[model samples]
Target: MTQWLVLAAAIAVEVFATLGLRASEGFRKKAWIAPVVLGYLASFYGLWLTLRLGMPVGIAYGVWTACGVALVAVIARYVFRDPLTWKMIIGIGLIVAGVLTIELAGVVH
Candidate 1:
Protein backbone atom coordinates (compact mmCIF):
# COMPACT_ATOMS: atom_id res chain seq x y z
CA MET A 1 0.00 0.00 0.00
CA THR A 2 2.68 2.45 0.99
CA GLN A 3 4.76 1.41 -1.96
CA TRP A 4 1.90 2.07 -4.32
CA LEU A 5 1.47 5.49 -2.77
CA VAL A 6 5.13 6.21 -3.28
CA LEU A 7 4.90 5.12 -6.88
CA ALA A 8 1.91 7.35 -7.44
CA ALA A 9 3.72 10.31 -5.94
CA ALA A 10 6.74 9.56 -8.07
CA ILE A 11 4.63 9.50 -11.20
CA ALA A 12 3.05 12.82 -10.33
CA VAL A 13 6.43 14.35 -9.60
CA GLU A 14 7.84 13.10 -12.86
CA VAL A 15 4.92 14.60 -14.76
CA PHE A 16 5.54 17.89 -13.02
CA ALA A 17 9.20 17.80 -13.87
CA THR A 18 8.38 17.14 -17.51
CA LEU A 19 6.04 20.09 -17.56
CA GLY A 20 8.81 22.18 -16.11
CA LEU A 21 11.00 21.06 -18.95
CA ARG A 22 8.57 22.48 -21.46
CA ALA A 23 8.22 25.67 -19.53
CA SER A 24 11.99 25.97 -19.50
CA GLU A 25 11.92 26.59 -23.23
CA GLY A 26 14.71 24.16 -24.08
CA PHE A 27 16.56 25.24 -20.96
CA ARG A 28 16.85 28.75 -22.30
CA LYS A 29 14.83 30.15 -19.43
CA LYS A 30 16.90 30.16 -16.28
CA ALA A 31 13.95 30.59 -13.96
CA TRP A 32 12.69 27.09 -14.59
CA ILE A 33 16.03 25.31 -14.21
CA ALA A 34 16.18 24.77 -10.49
CA PRO A 35 12.63 23.52 -10.26
CA VAL A 36 12.94 21.20 -13.22
CA VAL A 37 16.14 19.67 -11.91
CA LEU A 38 14.88 19.37 -8.35
CA GLY A 39 11.62 17.88 -9.47
CA TYR A 40 13.39 15.19 -11.45
CA LEU A 41 15.74 14.42 -8.61
CA ALA A 42 12.88 14.11 -6.15
CA SER A 43 10.87 11.95 -8.51
CA PHE A 44 13.75 9.52 -9.07
CA TYR A 45 14.34 9.34 -5.34
CA GLY A 46 10.70 8.49 -4.84
CA LEU A 47 11.02 5.70 -7.37
CA TRP A 48 13.97 4.35 -5.49
CA LEU A 49 12.04 4.39 -2.25
CA THR A 50 9.14 2.59 -3.89
CA LEU A 51 11.47 -0.06 -5.24
CA ARG A 52 13.07 -0.42 -1.84
CA LEU A 53 9.63 -1.06 -0.45
CA GLY A 54 9.39 -4.18 -2.63
CA MET A 55 7.73 -3.05 -5.85
CA PRO A 56 9.40 -4.60 -8.88
CA VAL A 57 11.35 -2.26 -11.13
CA GLY A 58 9.53 -3.20 -14.32
CA ILE A 59 6.09 -2.56 -12.90
CA ALA A 60 7.18 0.62 -11.17
CA TYR A 61 8.75 2.08 -14.29
CA GLY A 62 5.82 1.09 -16.47
CA VAL A 63 3.29 2.74 -14.20
CA TRP A 64 5.48 5.79 -13.65
CA THR A 65 6.02 6.39 -17.36
CA ALA A 66 2.48 5.56 -18.38
CA CYS A 67 0.91 7.98 -15.96
CA GLY A 68 3.51 10.64 -16.70
CA VAL A 69 2.96 10.42 -20.44
CA ALA A 70 -0.82 10.53 -20.20
CA LEU A 71 -0.91 13.34 -17.72
CA VAL A 72 1.69 15.37 -19.60
CA ALA A 73 -0.19 15.05 -22.87
CA VAL A 74 -3.50 16.17 -21.42
CA ILE A 75 -1.99 18.92 -19.34
CA ALA A 76 0.20 20.16 -22.16
CA ARG A 77 -2.85 20.46 -24.35
CA TYR A 78 -4.27 22.94 -21.89
CA VAL A 79 -1.10 24.61 -20.69
CA PHE A 80 0.94 24.83 -23.86
CA ARG A 81 -1.66 24.34 -26.58
CA ASP A 82 0.59 21.61 -27.91
CA PRO A 83 -1.81 19.95 -30.32
CA LEU A 84 -3.81 17.17 -28.77
CA THR A 85 -5.27 15.54 -31.80
CA TRP A 86 -7.48 12.47 -31.68
CA LYS A 87 -4.66 10.36 -33.07
CA MET A 88 -2.34 11.41 -30.27
CA ILE A 89 -5.04 10.72 -27.77
CA ILE A 90 -5.49 7.28 -29.21
CA GLY A 91 -1.79 6.68 -29.01
CA ILE A 92 -1.70 7.73 -25.40
CA GLY A 93 -4.60 5.43 -24.67
CA LEU A 94 -2.78 2.56 -26.33
CA ILE A 95 0.37 3.24 -24.36
CA VAL A 96 -1.55 3.29 -21.11
CA ALA A 97 -3.45 0.17 -22.07
CA GLY A 98 -0.26 -1.68 -22.86
CA VAL A 99 1.26 -0.71 -19.53
CA LEU A 100 -1.86 -1.71 -17.66
CA THR A 101 -1.90 -5.05 -19.43
CA ILE A 102 1.63 -5.66 -18.26
CA GLU A 103 0.78 -4.60 -14.74
CA LEU A 104 -2.36 -6.72 -14.43
CA ALA A 105 -0.81 -9.76 -16.03
CA GLY A 106 2.15 -9.69 -13.67
CA VAL A 107 4.38 -9.89 -16.69
CA VAL A 108 7.40 -8.70 -14.69
CA HIS A 109 8.50 -10.08 -11.39
Candidate 2:
Protein backbone atom coordinates (compact mmCIF):
# COMPACT_ATOMS: atom_id res chain seq x y z
CA MET A 1 0.00 0.00 0.00
CA THR A 2 2.75 2.43 0.89
CA GLN A 3 4.60 1.54 -2.31
CA TRP A 4 1.52 2.25 -4.36
CA LEU A 5 1.11 5.57 -2.59
CA VAL A 6 4.69 6.47 -3.37
CA LEU A 7 4.17 5.52 -6.99
CA ALA A 8 1.10 7.70 -7.19
CA ALA A 9 2.97 10.60 -5.68
CA ALA A 10 5.79 10.06 -8.14
CA ILE A 11 3.36 10.19 -11.04
CA ALA A 12 1.76 13.38 -9.75
CA VAL A 13 5.12 15.02 -9.21
CA GLU A 14 6.25 14.01 -12.68
CA VAL A 15 3.14 15.54 -14.18
CA PHE A 16 3.82 18.78 -12.33
CA ALA A 17 7.38 18.78 -13.58
CA THR A 18 6.14 18.32 -17.12
CA LEU A 19 3.79 21.26 -16.69
CA GLY A 20 6.67 23.25 -15.32
CA LEU A 21 8.60 22.32 -18.45
CA ARG A 22 5.98 23.98 -20.59
CA ALA A 23 5.90 27.03 -18.35
CA SER A 24 9.68 27.21 -18.58
CA GLU A 25 9.38 28.04 -22.28
CA GLY A 26 12.24 25.83 -23.36
CA PHE A 27 14.18 26.72 -20.24
CA ARG A 28 14.00 30.39 -21.11
CA LYS A 29 12.00 31.31 -18.02
CA LYS A 30 13.96 31.43 -14.78
CA ALA A 31 11.07 31.24 -12.37
CA TRP A 32 9.76 27.89 -13.64
CA ILE A 33 13.15 26.23 -13.40
CA ALA A 34 13.00 25.68 -9.69
CA PRO A 35 9.72 23.78 -9.76
CA VAL A 36 10.74 21.85 -12.81
CA VAL A 37 14.00 20.72 -11.29
CA LEU A 38 12.68 20.12 -7.82
CA GLY A 39 9.61 18.30 -9.06
CA TYR A 40 11.73 15.93 -11.15
CA LEU A 41 14.10 15.34 -8.25
CA ALA A 42 11.25 14.55 -5.93
CA SER A 43 9.53 12.38 -8.51
CA PHE A 44 12.60 10.23 -9.10
CA TYR A 45 13.17 9.90 -5.39
CA GLY A 46 9.63 8.63 -4.98
CA LEU A 47 10.08 6.23 -7.88
CA TRP A 48 13.25 4.92 -6.32
CA LEU A 49 11.51 4.38 -3.04
CA THR A 50 8.68 2.57 -4.78
CA LEU A 51 11.11 0.26 -6.52
CA ARG A 52 12.97 -0.37 -3.30
CA LEU A 53 9.69 -1.46 -1.84
CA GLY A 54 9.76 -4.36 -4.33
CA MET A 55 7.51 -3.23 -7.14
CA PRO A 56 8.51 -4.73 -10.46
CA VAL A 57 10.33 -2.22 -12.64
CA GLY A 58 8.31 -2.91 -15.75
CA ILE A 59 4.95 -2.70 -14.05
CA ALA A 60 5.91 0.38 -12.09
CA TYR A 61 7.14 2.24 -15.15
CA GLY A 62 4.14 1.23 -17.25
CA VAL A 63 1.61 2.37 -14.67
CA TRP A 64 3.49 5.54 -13.85
CA THR A 65 3.88 6.68 -17.46
CA ALA A 66 0.36 5.72 -18.52
CA CYS A 67 -1.28 7.64 -15.68
CA GLY A 68 1.04 10.56 -16.16
CA VAL A 69 0.22 10.77 -19.85
CA ALA A 70 -3.50 10.73 -19.27
CA LEU A 71 -3.41 13.26 -16.46
CA VAL A 72 -1.14 15.59 -18.38
CA ALA A 73 -3.38 15.49 -21.40
CA VAL A 74 -6.45 16.44 -19.40
CA ILE A 75 -4.68 19.03 -17.32
CA ALA A 76 -2.93 20.59 -20.27
CA ARG A 77 -6.18 20.96 -22.10
CA TYR A 78 -7.59 23.06 -19.28
CA VAL A 79 -4.44 24.85 -18.19
CA PHE A 80 -2.85 25.65 -21.54
CA ARG A 81 -5.89 25.48 -23.76
CA ASP A 82 -4.17 22.65 -25.53
CA PRO A 83 -6.24 20.72 -28.00
CA LEU A 84 -7.61 17.36 -26.89
CA THR A 85 -8.65 15.74 -30.08
CA TRP A 86 -10.38 12.39 -30.50
CA LYS A 87 -7.12 10.82 -31.63
CA MET A 88 -5.43 11.83 -28.41
CA ILE A 89 -8.33 10.57 -26.36
CA ILE A 90 -8.20 7.26 -28.13
CA GLY A 91 -4.49 7.03 -27.60
CA ILE A 92 -4.93 7.67 -23.91
CA GLY A 93 -7.48 4.90 -23.75
CA LEU A 94 -5.12 2.50 -25.39
CA ILE A 95 -2.36 3.43 -23.00
CA VAL A 96 -4.67 2.85 -20.07
CA ALA A 97 -5.76 -0.51 -21.40
CA GLY A 98 -2.19 -1.54 -21.93
CA VAL A 99 -1.29 -0.63 -18.37
CA LEU A 100 -4.24 -2.59 -17.05
CA THR A 101 -3.23 -5.61 -19.06
CA ILE A 102 0.27 -5.48 -17.68
CA GLU A 103 -0.97 -5.14 -14.14
CA LEU A 104 -3.42 -8.00 -14.47
CA ALA A 105 -0.74 -10.18 -15.94
CA GLY A 106 1.46 -9.49 -12.97
CA VAL A 107 -1.33 -10.51 -10.66
CA VAL A 108 -2.00 -13.72 -12.52
CA HIS A 109 1.62 -14.77 -12.41
Candidate 3:
Protein backbone atom coordinates (compact mmCIF):
# COMPACT_ATOMS: atom_id res chain seq x y z
CA MET A 1 0.00 0.00 0.00
CA THR A 2 2.75 2.38 0.93
CA GLN A 3 4.70 1.34 -2.12
CA TRP A 4 1.73 2.09 -4.35
CA LEU A 5 1.35 5.51 -2.80
CA VAL A 6 5.01 6.20 -3.38
CA LEU A 7 4.70 5.07 -6.95
CA ALA A 8 1.70 7.35 -7.41
CA ALA A 9 3.68 10.29 -6.09
CA ALA A 10 6.53 9.36 -8.41
CA ILE A 11 4.21 9.33 -11.38
CA ALA A 12 2.58 12.63 -10.41
CA VAL A 13 5.89 14.38 -10.03
CA GLU A 14 7.13 12.99 -13.29
CA VAL A 15 4.05 14.37 -15.02
CA PHE A 16 4.63 17.69 -13.29
CA ALA A 17 8.22 17.65 -14.49
CA THR A 18 7.19 16.86 -18.04
CA LEU A 19 4.68 19.68 -18.08
CA GLY A 20 7.38 21.86 -16.64
CA LEU A 21 9.58 20.89 -19.54
CA ARG A 22 6.94 22.25 -21.90
CA ALA A 23 6.77 25.42 -19.87
CA SER A 24 10.52 25.75 -19.91
CA GLU A 25 10.42 26.06 -23.71
CA GLY A 26 13.83 24.56 -24.37
CA PHE A 27 15.06 26.24 -21.20
CA ARG A 28 14.47 29.66 -22.69
CA LYS A 29 12.23 30.41 -19.72
CA LYS A 30 14.63 30.49 -16.81
CA ALA A 31 11.88 30.65 -14.24
CA TRP A 32 10.59 27.16 -15.05
CA ILE A 33 14.02 25.58 -14.79
CA ALA A 34 14.12 25.25 -11.04
CA PRO A 35 10.68 23.70 -10.67
CA VAL A 36 11.35 21.28 -13.51
CA VAL A 37 14.64 20.13 -12.06
CA LEU A 38 13.28 19.80 -8.55
CA GLY A 39 10.23 17.91 -9.73
CA TYR A 40 12.38 15.40 -11.61
CA LEU A 41 14.68 14.91 -8.65
CA ALA A 42 11.76 14.37 -6.28
CA SER A 43 10.19 11.96 -8.75
CA PHE A 44 13.32 9.85 -8.86
CA TYR A 45 13.50 9.78 -5.09
CA GLY A 46 9.91 8.56 -4.90
CA LEU A 47 10.67 5.83 -7.37
CA TRP A 48 13.61 4.75 -5.23
CA LEU A 49 11.41 4.57 -2.17
CA THR A 50 8.89 2.38 -3.97
CA LEU A 51 11.62 -0.02 -5.08
CA ARG A 52 13.15 -0.18 -1.61
CA LEU A 53 9.68 -0.88 -0.27
CA GLY A 54 9.59 -4.11 -2.34
CA MET A 55 7.76 -3.00 -5.48
CA PRO A 56 9.23 -4.90 -8.44
CA VAL A 57 11.30 -2.73 -10.74
CA GLY A 58 9.38 -3.80 -13.81
CA ILE A 59 6.01 -3.00 -12.31
CA ALA A 60 7.18 0.21 -10.76
CA TYR A 61 8.69 1.53 -13.96
CA GLY A 62 5.77 0.40 -16.09
CA VAL A 63 3.15 2.05 -13.95
CA TRP A 64 5.21 5.15 -13.38
CA THR A 65 5.94 5.74 -17.04
CA ALA A 66 2.50 4.77 -18.29
CA CYS A 67 0.65 6.99 -15.89
CA GLY A 68 3.08 9.81 -16.43
CA VAL A 69 2.82 9.62 -20.18
CA ALA A 70 -0.97 9.44 -20.17
CA LEU A 71 -1.41 12.23 -17.68
CA VAL A 72 1.08 14.47 -19.41
CA ALA A 73 -0.50 14.01 -22.80
CA VAL A 74 -4.02 14.70 -21.57
CA ILE A 75 -2.99 17.66 -19.52
CA ALA A 76 -0.86 19.10 -22.26
CA ARG A 77 -3.77 18.89 -24.64
CA TYR A 78 -5.61 21.40 -22.51
CA VAL A 79 -2.81 23.37 -20.91
CA PHE A 80 -0.41 23.61 -23.83
CA ARG A 81 -2.94 23.26 -26.62
CA ASP A 82 -1.11 20.16 -27.78
CA PRO A 83 -2.88 17.90 -30.18
CA LEU A 84 -4.67 14.86 -28.83
CA THR A 85 -5.76 13.19 -32.00
CA TRP A 86 -7.38 9.82 -32.28
CA LYS A 87 -4.16 8.18 -33.37
CA MET A 88 -2.35 9.49 -30.31
CA ILE A 89 -5.18 8.41 -28.10
CA ILE A 90 -4.96 4.91 -29.51
CA GLY A 91 -1.24 4.87 -28.91
CA ILE A 92 -1.78 5.90 -25.31
CA GLY A 93 -4.33 3.15 -24.87
CA LEU A 94 -1.87 0.59 -26.18
CA ILE A 95 0.75 1.88 -23.80
CA VAL A 96 -1.59 1.43 -20.87
CA ALA A 97 -2.40 -2.11 -22.00
CA GLY A 98 1.27 -2.95 -22.33
CA VAL A 99 2.01 -1.73 -18.83
CA LEU A 100 -0.82 -3.79 -17.43
CA THR A 101 0.47 -6.84 -19.22
CA ILE A 102 3.98 -6.31 -17.89
CA GLU A 103 2.69 -5.88 -14.34
CA LEU A 104 0.54 -9.02 -14.51
CA ALA A 105 3.41 -10.94 -16.01
CA GLY A 106 5.64 -9.90 -13.14
CA VAL A 107 3.05 -11.00 -10.62
CA VAL A 108 2.80 -14.45 -12.18
CA HIS A 109 6.50 -15.00 -11.90
For model 3, the run of ten residues with the poorest summed lDDT: 61-70
Better of 1 and 3 by TM-score: 3
Candidate 3 lDDT over residue span 1-109, tens digit each: 9999999999999899999999999999999999999999999999999999999998999899889989999999999999999999999999999999999888898
lDDT (0 to 1) per candidate: 0.92, 0.95, 0.95
Off by over 4 Å in 2: none
On residues 1-102, what C-alpha lDDT tens digit does candidate 2 reach at each position?
A: 999999999999999999999878899999999999999999999999999999998789999999999999999999999999999999999999999999
TM match of model 2 to true structure: 0.97
Q: What would the TM-scores of all predictions be? A: 0.94, 0.97, 0.97
In candidate 2, how many Å is residue 18 off?
A: 0.4
Q: Model 1, 1-109: lDDT tens per residue?
A: 9999999999888999999999999999999999999999999999999999998887899889888889999999999999999999999999989888988888544
Clashing pairs in 1: none
Better of 1 and 3 by lDDT: 3
lDDT for model 1 comes to 0.92
